[model samples]
Target: MNILEVNNLNKYFRQPTEFHVLKDLNFNVEKGKLTSITGKSGSGKSTLLYLLSTMDTDFDGSINISENEIKGKDNNWLANFRNEHIGFIFQFHFLLPEFSVFDNVMLPALKLGKLSKEEIENNAFELLCLLDVADQGKKKASLLSGGEQQRVAIARALINQPTLIIGDEPTGNLDSQNTAIVLDLFKELCKEKGQTILTVTHDEDFADRSDRIIHLKDGRIVT
Candidate 1:
């Protein structure tokens, strides 16, 4: 089944001048699959990801995820929908420095309020274990190494078990070893939990290993 669909997407930037960034893009990402969006630096790959994640709403066309049409939705509605259905991992691990690793991971679930505090804590611990950061749970997020911090970010992303995990250069800051770990983890999530992932990456090996690679050029899919 398709977890995401983008149809006739067009975006523009009118700041300096009217410049078209994305042009009539369309695609579908299947459930339980890992997909990558790749392109040259100016090809709008990241813009596409922002749109797919429902964080940018100034584009034209329809974006449907898990049967919900996200285009035209208000920011409040989009924010809530995103919390319930989408997990995001950015290039920078945006953890609260003052919070413990466990607390950072549990924040989303806490905001969600769908589970008891105890249950959320348990879930957070399990996610930490899955990411191989179980021992860091009691440490301050700022105290962890770069790779460990990224793993903790991944754990936090999974805390809510979002139907789709969207990543923007998720391994950008990691060393080769940690990058491999994250790539493997993404594959595992798709295989074991039927999770859908859509990531924008410049890492060729990362894009090549995904189930599908949507290559863009000059704001259009070239493949």
Candidate 2:
């Protein structure tokens, strides 16, 4: 089954005139597949992730998730859908410095108010354990190492049990060893849990681990 479908997607930024970022991009990601989107700096890889995650709405064309078109969904519904069905990991960890690692992971569940406090804590702890960071859960995010912090972010992203997990340069900040560790974790999760993932990266090593690679040049697919 296809989990995501983007057809003839076109996104333009208007500075003075229209400058296109994505041009007639079309792609489909199947359920339980780990896919990579790779391109140069000026390419629309991150923009595509934002659009797929419903964080950016300034675009033209159709994006369907489970047969529901994104264009027909209201902002309120889209926000809810993203929170409930999608998990995001950006290059920056985006963890609140003042919060404990556990709290940061549980933040999504807290904001949605769908899970009870006890349930949220339980889920958060389980995710932390899964990521091998259970012992650091009580520590402040600011105290953890770069890799530890990224793992915490991953745990938090998984807290909601999202079917689609999107990561933009998630391992960009890590060293070679840490990068391998994190990449392996994502690979294991995708296989063991049957989660669909769409990741954007410039790292060839990281991109090679994916089941399929989508290469982009100047905002268009080249391979």
Candidate 3:
């Protein structure tokens, strides 16, 4: 089944002569599969990702996610929908330096308020363990190495068990070893838990390993 559908998407920049970025893009991402979106710089890969994440609304088209039409929703509704159904991982870990690793991971769940504090804490610990960062749960986020911090960020993204995980160069800052660790983790998430992942990446190897690669060129799907 398709968990995401984008139809007739068009985006443009009004400044400096109304440049068109994406052109009539249409695609469907299957449920429980890992998909990668790849393109060279300026090909509109990141722009497409931002739209897919529902964080960019100034576009023309329809985006249906998990059976809901989300393209026209207001920011307030989109924010709530995003919190409930989507998790994001960016190139930067973006953890609060003063917060403990556990606390950092628990923030989303707390904002979600769907479970008790104890339950959220337990869930965070489980995710941290899954990411192999459970041992650093009590440490301030700033104290961890870059790799460790990334793992914590992943755990945080998983805390709410979102239906879809959106990543933008999730391993961009990591070394080779850490990159391998993250790649394996994403594979495991797909194979073991049937999680759906959509990532925008420049890493060829990373894109090669995903279940599907949606290659874009000049704002159009090339593959």
Candidate 3 segments exceeding 4 Å error: none
> Deviation in angstroms for 181 in model 1?
0.6
* Model 3 residue pairs with clashes: none
Point out the higher-scoring one by TM-score: 1 or 2. 1
Look at candidate 1 and give me any clashing residue pairs: none
* lDDT (C-alpha, whole model) for all candidates: 0.93, 0.90, 0.93
> Could you tell which candidate, 1 or 2, scores higher by lDDT?
1
Candidate 1 residue-wise lDDT, 27-123, digit = tens: 9999999999999999999889888888888989999999999988999999999898999998999999999999999999999999999999999
Candidate 1 accuracy as lDDT: 0.93
What's the count of clashing pairs in each model shown?
0, 0, 0
| Window of ten residues with lowest summed lDDT in model 3 | 63-72
* Tens digit per residue, CA lDDT, model 3, 1-223: 8989999999999997899999999999988899999999999999998888998889999988999898778999999999989999999999999999999999999999999999999999889889999999999999999999999998988888888999999999999899999999999998898889999999999999999999999999999
Where model 2 places Cα greater than 4 Å from the true spot, the runs are none
After superposition, the stretches of candidate 1 with alpha carbons farther than 4 Å from their true spots are: none
Please estimate how well model 3 matches the true structure, expressed as its whole-model Cα lDDT. 0.93
The worst-scoring run of ten residues by lDDT in candidate 2 lies at: 65-74
Cα lDDT tens digits for candidate 2, 1-223:
9999999999999988979989998989998888999988888887788888887777899999877788867889998998988999988999999999989999999998998999999999998999899999899999999999999999988888887899989999999999999988988988898888889998999999899999989989988
